[model samples]
Target: MNTVLRLATAACLAVSGYLHAQLYVGGYRVIPLIGPSFLVQASAAFAVAVLVALGGPFLLRLAAAALAAGALAGFVLSRTTGLFGFSEQGFQPAPEALLSVLAEAAVLVLVAVTLYRVRRGTRTVRA
Candidate 1:
């Protein structure tokens, strides 16, 4: 179960990271301010995915939680309140956006479960 969860989390992270990174080439031209932010997010997310894939590390778990939460928050804020004055197309169920959100949410869930199990001393997986 731990292995499965870890892999699933990593997969979601990969997808989310890719989506975030894609903004560099896709939307960054329209919003130059977001380019740097997308680069940082993509790099951090990919690094976290690699760490989680490697195995249990206390720091990795913390990073995973932080990155997932941050990604989700950024996504929601960008879609609703419009991050940096650039709002998304307005909650219209865009396929790409939906996929990214779902992946981020999954990562959040899996990472939280992993953290809980680790805290309770019941986790069999390293991460």
Candidate 2:
């Protein structure tokens, strides 16, 4: 179960990274601010994916959690209130956006679970 969850988390991170990297092609024009932000996001996602695949150190898991939180916040702000003067087309669902959101959400859940398990294990060991 642990291995499966780890693999799943890594897969989700990879998918999320790809989606973020894709924004460079045409997404930058739609939201210029996204250019640098997306690049950073993609890089972080891939890095965290690697870390998760390797069985996560505490620092790595913490970084992954931060990245996931930032991504989620960016998605919500961009879609709703708009970020840096850039707003999505509308409230209607877009396939690509939905997929990205789902991938990020999955990463968030998986990473959280991994962190919880790690903390629990530490407590057991210390006790």
Candidate 3:
């Protein structure tokens, strides 16, 4: 279970890092409250990195779960916002919104599954 969690955490970080790096190139601004100049791609990457760096038995599970949820939301918003015909900025979804949504959905599933397993293990321990 720990191995799976570590793998999932690493995967999420990698995915987020890739996405963030793209945003940096694209010049997309980060969502407000998180950071002004912070890009979505960078934020996701940072979160994943933090989790992996802070891997402790006590908080690793919670951090992993939060990162998974954050990734899921980021993916969803990135996809759905463009469905309404938003202007194409440097970081905007290209071609179509559906593609972004689909991509995000896939990422979400991968992260979610890993988080779910971690959660289940925690629950089993508690019980």
Candidate 4:
């Protein structure tokens, strides 16, 4: 169960990371702060995903969840108030924007479920 959850979460993160990397190389690598942020996000996401997949550690799950949440937050900010003075209207990046958002969301849910199951199993059944 844990392995399944971890793999799922890692898959999600990998998807998100790929999208970010594609975006960065597609032309976003010149948006000042936004460009650099994208690169960092991509790298970190990949690294975390590998770690989580290799070992379903609680800390790794937490890190993965945080990464996904951060990506989602960045997406919202970029579409809403704006991220690093950059704002996109109505998912301007086409499928990448939407797909990445979905992937990140899934990572969050998967991580939460994984963590919940781990904690639940550790409790003593007060029968």
Candidate 5:
């Protein structure tokens, strides 16, 4: 179960990384701070995905969770208030935005389940 959760979470992160990288190359590269941020996000997501896929410890899961949550927050801000002085209407750039959101959300859910499993494993019954 733990292995499955790790792989699923890793896959989610990888999908998000791929989407962001594609967006960066597809012209977001000219968007100043936002451009660099996307690149960093892609890199981090890929790295964490690799670690998680390799059965890394809980710390790696924590990092993956953080990365996914951060991406989702950025997505929301970019659409709502603004992110790096940039705002966009409903999931612009076709399906990538929507896909990325779904992938990040999945990562969060998978990580949450992983957390529960780990916590449950560490619990001890009364004598």
Candidate 6:
């Protein structure tokens, strides 16, 4: 993938990760011990952005995909747990939960597009 697109994708993932981390501090059930885990995962996204900015296109795509998948799983787990937290007041998803899911989905798409572009570029150069 081109540098611009890769960097943009990484940036988006970073922002999403940070937003997801916010969930833990806003009257949620997150344990104090879980904070570091969330921070590390979120920081990984930002780290990938920095890595891509430093010209790690090949590695950035893979890293973004892995991060996106991990975020998706985390969000799903959150959603399931949310069910237990629900009551007759109607199911209220944690703040930014939906947005986080959407952002992860977008990152997944970006990863796929980047992979396809890289593969196409390679094939064109080879031919």
Q: In terms of lDDT, which candidate is strongest?
A: 5
Error of 5 at 46 (Å): 0.5
TM-score between candidate 4 and the true structure:
0.94
Candidate that beats the other on lDDT, 3 or 5, i.e. the better one: 5
Off by over 4 Å in 4: 125-127
- lDDT (Cα atoms) of all candidates against the true structure: 0.77, 0.76, 0.51, 0.90, 0.92, 0.68
Please estimate how well model 5 matches the true structure, expressed as its whole-model Cα lDDT: 0.92
Clashes by residue pair, model 3:
20-41
lDDT of 2: 0.76
Candidate 3 lDDT over residue span 42-111, tens digit each = 5655665566656646355455455545545655554567422422344345532334334345445655
Instruction: Please report, as a residue range, the 10-residue window in candidate 6 with the lowest summed lDDT.
Output: 82-91
For candidate 4, write residues 4-115 as lDDT tens digits.
8889999999999999999999999999999989999999999999988898467988998899999889888988999989999877799999899999999999988977
Each candidate's number of clashing pairs is 2, 0, 1, 0, 0, 0
Model 2 agreement with the true structure over 1-127: per-residue lDDT tens digits = 7788787888887787777787655456356677788888988889888988898765665676677778878888987888988667542235657777788788778878877887899999999
Q: What tens digits encode model 1's per-residue C-alpha lDDT throughout 11-53?
A: 8887888887886667664566667877888888898888888
Candidate 2, residue 23: how far the Cα is off, in Å: 2.1
Off by over 4 Å in 6: 27-33, 81-95
For 73-100, candidate 5 gives per-residue lDDT tens digits of 9999999999989989898888999999
Over 4 Å off, model 5: 124-127
lDDT of 6 by residue, 1-127 (tens): 3766777777778777777567545544255444555677777877886786677857776787788788677556555663334321222354466676677787788878878887898999999
Residue 122 of model 6, lDDT score: 91
Question: Which has the higher TM-score value, candidate number 5 or candidate number 6?
Answer: 5
